[model samples]
Target: MSDQEIPAREPSWQSRRLLSDRLDWNLLRTFLVIGEEKSISRAAARLFLTQSAVSQSLKRLEEQLECALILRRGPRFDLSPAGEEVLRLAEEIYGNVSRLAATAKNPQDDVVGKVRILTISQVQSDLYDDFLIQLHRDHPRVELEIEVMRSADIQSSLNQKTATIGLGLCRFPQTKLERRRLLRQRYAFFCGKRHRLFGQRRLPLEALQGENFVSFTSDQLGGNLSPLTMFRDQQGFTGKIVASSSSFEEIRRLIIAGYGVGCLPEHLVDIDLHNGLIWRLPPAEGVVDVDVFLMWNREQRMNHAETVFLDSFRRLLEAAGEE
Candidate 1:
């Protein structure tokens, strides 16, 4: 048989051997981060490693896989077809590893590991202090990563498994997530001490008909309608809005500066009300009520640290209610 006519051996065996080779899990983790962030610098920042180290790790990973996984496109990195397939498999690998790590911990050991929480900004201010203090006291080994996000984003993060828990105003239907009512946040009209109606006990709703009001913007309020609009439509308020802000603190400051009367959550202004810096006005007919919830992905398993933090949060709420 001529040498050229001999059957050529397929590369299947070599490819199978490469597939069976054990890769470093840490390197895979770095690759996953780079894949998700699409920037070596960003991934390095997230992983708390130097940019050069991440670059080297990526090089090593490609060498091990024996294929070019990523292609540099101007300022960003795009995954090659092989990279896409690897990323999909890497996600499953990491997901199973995470679940295994959660359950494989010694049952007798103290609660440990990181719990990522996503909450609304206002809700964080109201509860994080107490929650963090209690968490540290009870489970010193547990680390927390709290991100302030909009109410609309909180549930999405929970469903994506990016956040282990969420605390926010429950605006979505409870179809895919588990929700426990945490508290009823009350919103009512407020005025600074210098306001005309500050000293009055029972000012009528009609009295504010032409007054200017301060409130949060629609986006900040996490709804289609602004708080000012809700009050105007539901409580017979006819005030003109003089100012709007994305910051709750800014709105409070504006109200205190006598910019205009504003609606604020009771918890936010409780101290100001006590200090005589702000006064809570009578609701036109009733105060605006929002039900805040503790939410999580229904399908995810809660690790020990997460479970402990959740239980402590519930207790704190109960204690606050008693007071």
Candidate 2:
């Protein structure tokens, strides 16, 4: 119970570079490569090292951090929560380092930084494509890193300042973020080739009542796809709700597989319509349209590259409006 019996405490932040002095930075680089390749052998191949060497480096990192970075069992390979965080930080570090190296190689007054854009899956935007092409042509020094994610996640990234910009469905207003409509995607019901209602033309509203339906996981009242929910209600089709997913691709696949009638963005299914995989159902005018917006946290300080890209996108949008 004496003061000398107490264990020595670890040094705080006052011990400058104490922890950093002992950490091997190469292990972090090795771990980053491992995460990207998702295989120790592949990472080793890329690093021009042996598989055992790469594995040992990962083990060393885990030991130093006091947590496992990855879960490897049988044929499965995945990141642990701690691993995910480390990987994220590693990626940010690499991205910034890459930008710095590029700037050093080609010194210029040009915008030179990384723009991180988080967006929802499968966004069909001609304007966005044009903007990317133009940005590359105008500011080759600026790098763009895009990641696909859920709409809600996109907002979180924007609000948290992790993402420089975002493209997604706006479920509710976030006062901290500035938003502008990028595109409006229209939804229409479709039946699969094997469905009983396939190829049916101009069916009355009452015909859809009591019919089974597959839909987006967010297609509920006050949800991301609330417009679809409102339209389904208007038609008196209560939606038996056979299955659901957040992914539009899965919903389309299930509808094509004849699980139930489902809705998809009309622009996204032209190939399916042409290939006879699915036929458009009732409501010739189409049901509801969801607005996807280009959003960012204007209150946050943006790097030169991010600010340049945002202005470029706004200019493109304005020119489109003028046309």
Candidate 3:
């Protein structure tokens, strides 16, 4: 055959791999890392991948989408509008895929793998201490890792597969994770001993008006109504929050330090209430109530250890219900 007359060969399977036909899980992760970092080099460091590899992944993603996902400018890069949208959708898809994969994996009998549970500091303080004490006593073979993070982090932890379970005030959105509402959380408005409301048998809601208040941040409000929102809707709540924070510990200390009247979960401040360190605001109709949930990503094929752990957790939650 003449040098240029030979028939052209078909593209190699590797070259013909269709991005649309198969999802590249790593591509979504790479997109998220790069979007968060805004620099491929930085993302590469975070992902433990070479800059060149990161670049290749981006190229694949862009080629598959037939659009520029990122705009390179000098030493920096930013996602285009489309890229931002992709990132959002990719995150959702990644979460779903992870859940599917997790459920499909065969369980190991020994169950030696680490299990991560995400929760808030207060939940840990009020409930998990007893649970963990018993867990260790009964299941010494199962190693447990607990992460005390915010509610948002708890959601993200389960969403990102960083934690196998999440225990928090709010239930996760529709996902593969099964959420069981464990108990109702009650909040009490309270103030230091020096406050007028402290000595009263039951302070009127309006009486709280004009009183300086310390409160949780909007995010920390979780699914419950914000204190400010409660005050606006309820009569007799004339309190003014001079400071706000999401940290339960900080809020506790602030009230003790005489910052302002604050609301806290009863379990969190039960001891303080008894010690006279803080006094509850008189009960009012339609007070804020929160639902606490225990969420776990279930495996399609649960190992013996995983099954046992889940059962133990369910039992603990059930016992909490009795209290």
Note the Cα lDDT for every prediction shown: 0.72, 0.80, 0.67
Top model number, TM-score: 2
lDDT, residue 243, candidate 3? 80
Candidate 2: RMSD over Cα atoms?
Answer: 7.5
Model 1 residue 309 distance off true place after TM-score fit, in angstroms: 4.1
Model 3 per-residue lDDT at 168: 74
Error of 1 at 300 (Å): 2.9
**lDDT of candidate 2 over 216-314, digit per residue (tens):** 988888788988888877777865999899988889889999999888999999999999999998788888888898999877666778888888888
Those runs of model 1 whose alpha carbons end farther than 4 Å from true positions after fitting are 1-110, 122-138, 194-196, 218-228, 284-286, 301-304, 307-323
Mark the regions of model 3 whose C-alpha exceeds 4 Å error after superposition.
Answer: 1-78, 81-109, 124-131, 171-176, 194-197, 200-202, 219-222, 225-228, 236-238, 284-286, 298-305, 315-323
66-154 per-residue lDDT for model 3 (tens digits): 56677766566667777889888776666555444334333443343345567766663446567668867765666566778667657
Candidates 1 and 2: which is better by TM-score?
A: 2
Descending-TM-score candidate ranking = 2, 3, 1
Model 1, 1-323: lDDT tens digits are 32112232343667658755667778888988888778889999989999989988887777667666787766666887778888877776775565444444545567876678887766634465767876788777777777886676677656656567888866556677877777777778888988888878878777776778887775234472354475576656666778987667888999999988888778777789889999777764345777778888777667777777777776776677621
lDDT for model 3: 0.67
* Window of ten residues with lowest summed lDDT in model 1: 1-10
What TM-score, to 2 decimals, does candidate 1 have? 0.59
